[model samples]
Structure formats: structure tokens, C-alpha cells
Target: MPHAYQPPQRRSRLTRRGRLLLLFTALLGLGLGATVLLPLLSPGEAPEKPRQLLIPEGWRAAQVYAAIDKE
Candidate 1:
């Protein structure tokens, strides 16, 4: 059987602006994905819990050291 002659289809090409838009979209997606997944990839727990020390209103570091020195 003989095949009928057919015209070739025009290939679609991306313009420079379209290519830049695609690149921008891809980078934006990657950045958002990293932001979402970063917390899950971090360490499970902090090494130590934060502590708050209480000191009397008028006390100073020097006074604290002097008190410790007398011990």
C-alpha cells in the first residue's frame, strides 16, 4: 500500500521570554519545596533546653562571684 503525502507539522518553539518564565517558575517551586521540607530534615531535638536564671533586683555579677567565693 502507498502512503499519502502529508505536510509536516510546524514545531512549537519557546521564545526567550517564555524560557525565562519557565526558569523562574522552576526556581520558585524548588525554593518553596526546600522551605517546606527543611524543618523535617533538621535534628529531632535541641541539645539543651533554654534556662532562665533569677537574680535579685539590685544584685550584680560581682556580688554573685563574691558569694560563691565565700562558699
Candidate 2:
């Protein structure tokens, strides 16, 4: 009697439910990272410093030029 050949069983890398679960998990992680972690990791702007300038009373233009030249 002659025996019939049998084909090998096929295996799936990912099932439909597994694919959906993986996609959902990836989206959830991204959403949490953007909403919760991004702000915590970002740097805030530094506070501005006050500026001051001084001018002498009755100062002549020539005097200012001489003072700047000395510096």
C-alpha cells in the first residue's frame, strides 16, 4: 500500500488580537510620555535680570569722550 504525503502546519508570527493589543500598548505609552514625562523633562526659561545706567550731572560731550578714551 502507498502512503499519502502530509503538508507541514503553518504558524503565524502574530495573531489579530495580539497585533491589536500591541498597537494599543504603543499608543498608550506614547500618550503617557507626551502628556506626563515631556513637561517634567523640559527646561524652563531663566528669570530676567534688572539693568541700571548711571550718568553724571552737567557732564560735557568732550568730558564723556575723554573718559571713554581713558578706558
What candidate 2 gets wrong by more than 4 Å, as runs, is 1-12, 41-71
Residue 68 error for model 2, in Å? Answer: 54
Q: Score every model by TM-score.
A: 0.51, 0.39
Residue 54 C-alpha lDDT in model 2: 46
- Pairs that collide in candidate 2 are none
Weakest 10 consecutive residues of candidate 2 by summed lDDT: 46-55
Please report the candidate that would top lDDT against the real structure: 1
RMSD of each: 9.1, 12.2
12-60 per-residue lDDT for model 1 (tens digits): 9999999999999999999999998998898777668765555567888
